[model samples]
Target: MLPLAPSFDTVGWLTRDLATLDRVVRVMLPEGSRAASGAAIPEVLLSVLDPAVVQAFRSAVALLVERGGFDKPDDVELPDVKATYAAFRTVQAAEAWRVHGPWLTEHPGSVSGAVADRFRVAAAVTPDEERRARNVLAEARGALRALLAERTLLLPSAASPAPQASAGGAEVDRVRGATLTLTCLAAVAGAPSLSAPLARVGGAPLGVALVSAPGSDRSLLELAGALVDETAVP
Candidate 1:
């Protein structure tokens, strides 16, 4: 889950991540279209959400942010988070279609051909749309950072697990696990660490961990469990 506080710097961290995402979109989008200036095309793409792809992306982002501590028990206005997540997926799907659309149409019988055909249609109809999605994704990233800036200090929740005693330090051990996960998330997002110590538990560095897992994989679940466990530990 994304951390909401304790790592207020996550806003800056997200900004850097978005910049990297922009680079990725540039590389994936049509050669010339990527270089074209203005956010017009990208905006249009964001407006049209691909049900499956955008939903998947939103789910993944929500899970990731929630793990990092950005989630609030009370509803938080996170338009940027939702928008960015959707745009990222849309751009990725569009780019995939652009690259493989022709191949799919050529070999309709094959799975690749089928996928390619779908992409081909998507690209053909929404050439500018793909670029627009990328731009929206960038903007969403920026918005998330701004949102995070206002928050500070993340508290543990009932969902978290019990902390374990370790020689290094109880808090340190708990934080170590969270830190490891957060660092991995940062690497994936192309963002820096927005993690900080929240408290001291049995001489351990118990802090709110802000990891970023993109999908609901076993590894991510395990890490989340660890985070919650540490928090719940007495």
Candidate 2:
């Protein structure tokens, strides 16, 4: 049988406000995975506004669960993805400042213009550091684009299938596992475009899950299990 549902406090790491977090989790989770039935609409709205909080919550959960790693079936390399993502984020931030700086100069009262002074400072870095930062940013953008273009799970298609359990229960287990995995992928793929929303809420860009199902506990467990299994091999 599946493990008992994780407590709200335990899952609370998924968001700051209990009500808002609960909504996102509910929408993303499947019926079988819910800890209990309740509406979390308020939590969802608040969460969308603070993407960083949501991201922090997600990262914490991933670390605790040991899923969503680079070596997992998802083929996400945390370090590499993070490095690339950070670089891209830097570039995006700089560009935003660059644009806002001039606009702010022209229209002082506009928020972007008002913030231009800070942007100008960020945009003006030491030559050597700036060059290195630019190079890293370019590389990161390319890497993200490539990842976005891919159609398959991160792991090699040739990786051996997970071993079957003992004979009598093996087929049932396999079918269940496969179904769960597919459901997880679907949910992750269908997640909202968090980039802009995150920026609007957090006043900065943060790494967002490319795929996540808000309320799908089974998917979460399956993903966590896959990451654990893959990481353990060899």
Candidate 3:
């Protein structure tokens, strides 16, 4: 909520169960939401990923259909994953720079060198680059909104299992990059994405996400609750 990038920033919270999440959603969002409604995982999204992460995502989708009473997701074509991620990064960075660059400039070394470096790169985003990225984002938003007009797109919350507290920067960045590729779809589309903490990999928890049309968040949460109840162990 600190305005990482206003274009993609949203206010969300952590909840332990779907019931609690529902309570919060009722207070935060208006009622009377209606339904809006992927059979294929993009290879680009799965390429070079950890086997555990890949399996978790696939299993999550299967669970949604096999148990949650949801229909098999339609196999829809997505725009180029790598290109979409790049454009999202550009717009996010440019907006972030617009928000925080002045403060960062005034306070040298107040933040980590890596954080400062990222802001520096953001500061350097050119007008032409931002414009191109905006165009790409516009197209992607349309494509995704249309795709979700009648169906939800399911996804993994991250591309890798949780890393150790002491994980190196390179390992962290690798996970972050892959995770962003999966998440940036909803961000670029400006859609509502809900994650159900219903999957595990080698006993570690991983969440599966449901992305849907903008006004369909309440219904999406109801679907997520169904997934949780359906998959819960006796």
Candidate 4:
């Protein structure tokens, strides 16, 4: 689906348990792969954290420190995230236009209203904008990869727990903004993030995301499994 944007696009699974996912990673990666570990994990994506989400992360981090014997995570300097997000969006839209515009134009009637509008926006992204966005992606990957060379990153999977099924439009938008804020860090950096389902609010499940440099998918999965095992979360 991401022809022009293949550099950043990847495929993975979502599940109820991290251990099962870890086993799948074990089978996929080459033998003798080792998970990376170190102090000084740079944490990000706090601007969108809901109160409940914040609490869940704090609890999860405490568990990790107590059980895994890791130091508490501290804030690390990062580049302009808003700019990074804009760059990712530009590149993604440019590529989406290239990959999906032809068929969508031929069968315009088959597309949903919102999706068609998105395609229209993609079809309008300028080449200059795409070039700038690609530069931002490269610089971001370089910076984040250096930060993650020996340490992992921690973030919330979403801004908050699952919204009530009856949530209104404004509420849904709020949730989406928060989710994008946290998720784009990994996506734009072309890293793999393992979702750890260690949080609950109002009896609904949520996740704390653990992200690492590219090529560390196996390590991320294994670390997530250990977090679950130590805390007996899922």
Per-model lDDT:
0.37, 0.35, 0.79, 0.72
TM-score of each: 0.33, 0.30, 0.91, 0.87
lDDT tens digits by residue: candidate 4, 84-176: 878877887888888878887888687775566667879999998889888988898788777777668777678788788998867987787
After the best TM-score superposition of candidate 4, give how far the Cα of residue 137 lies from its true spot, in angstroms: 1.3
Evaluated against the true structure, the overall lDDT of model 2 is: 0.35
Best by lDDT: 3
Q: Deviation in angstroms for 125 in model 3?
A: 0.6
The per-residue C-alpha lDDT of model 1 at residue 58 equals 38
Worst 10 residues of 1 by lDDT: 33-42
Q: For candidate 1, write residues 1-234 as lDDT tens digits.
A: 433112122333222233353455345433321110100111222234324323333343344355663343222343343455445545655655555556656776666443444455456646677677667755655643443333321222111233455435546544444333223223224332223233333344433433222221223223333334234332
Give stretches of model 4 more than 4 Å off.
1-4, 31-35, 39-44
Query: Which has the greatest TM-score?
Result: 3
**Candidate structures ordered by lDDT, highest first:** 3, 4, 1, 2
